[model samples]
Target: MTMKIKKILLTTDFSDYAHYALTYAVEFADKFKAEIGLLHVIEPIIAPTDFTWESYDIAELEKKSREYTQESLDKIIREKIPDKIKATPIIRYGRSFEEIIRCAKEEEFDIIIMSTHGLTGISHILFGSTAEKVVRKSPVPVLTVRDPEHKFEML
Candidate 1:
């Protein structure tokens, strides 16, 4: 069957690895003439039981997180992604893999593209892999770009 990618979801953690994946996503979007949706998921903040954390504090933290995520997204759009590519920025608070899968399914993205940290051995066992989890759980196709260990041309 022929695959038609109308909408592409690109998940980023604002790390070097994620940025590397952005290059691939932009290239694919340009070639396919697809709209790009950029998503950044922030882990929910847990209040310490020992210290009485006020609701206002939590609110402030959420505000800051949203602002920071927006700024980063804007920077990528302005500097990395080309103007011709239709792109939207989204910020959510939750588990990364779950949030990504939810967004991809709910937004009706044709595919999800994200970067893998390329961790292995004990570190991989301890930290697990978000991309791996999403690949298994996501309803749509998931494309995982690994760290830039191999030289590849970027369009």
Candidate 2:
């Protein structure tokens, strides 16, 4: 069966693993002639003590985070992706997996492409896996790309 991919959602944590996934997302977007929406989710900061900062201070922090995230997204588009590809940077503040799923559903993305950290065993148990959670909960098809460091035989 043929699938129509007009919109592609690419999620990143600004990590090397995520950078590797971006390459695949770009290739798919090129093949399908799709518009790419690059997403970065910043976990909401919670004050440790009862004495909380003013709303203005919180707003400033969020603004800075958005600016930094946008810069990073722009750098990837300018340096890595070709100029012809239609790409937009999206910044959302919340839990990574939740925000990713919400964006994909709300925006009606055709598919989601993201990198997995490839954590396993004790580490996986302790930290859990964002990719795994996203894959399970995502409304659309999710393509989980593994880091290049985890080599596998083609056979």
> How far does residue 153 in candidate 1 sit from its true spot (Å)?
23
Candidate 1 TM-score, true structure as reference: 0.87
> lDDT by residue for model 2 over 55-121, one digit each (tens)?
3477788789889989999998888878889999898888788999999999999999999873234
State the lDDT of candidate 1 residue by residue for 1-155, as single tens digits: 97899999999888888999999899999999999999999888888866577545888898898999999999999899999999999887898889999999889999999987632348558768888899889999989998868677899
- The lDDT, on a scale of 0 to 1, for candidate 2 is 0.87
With candidate 2 superimposed using the best TM-score fit, by how many Å does residue 52's alpha carbon deviate from the native? 11
Runs off by more than 4 Å, candidate 2? 50-56, 118-124, 151-155
Instruction: Report residue 148 deviation for candidate 2 (angstroms).
Output: 1.6
lDDT of 2 at 16: 86
lDDT of 2 at 72: 96
Give model 2's TM-score versus the native structure. Answer: 0.86
Stretches > 4 Å off in candidate 1:
52-56, 118-124, 150-155
Best by TM-score: 1
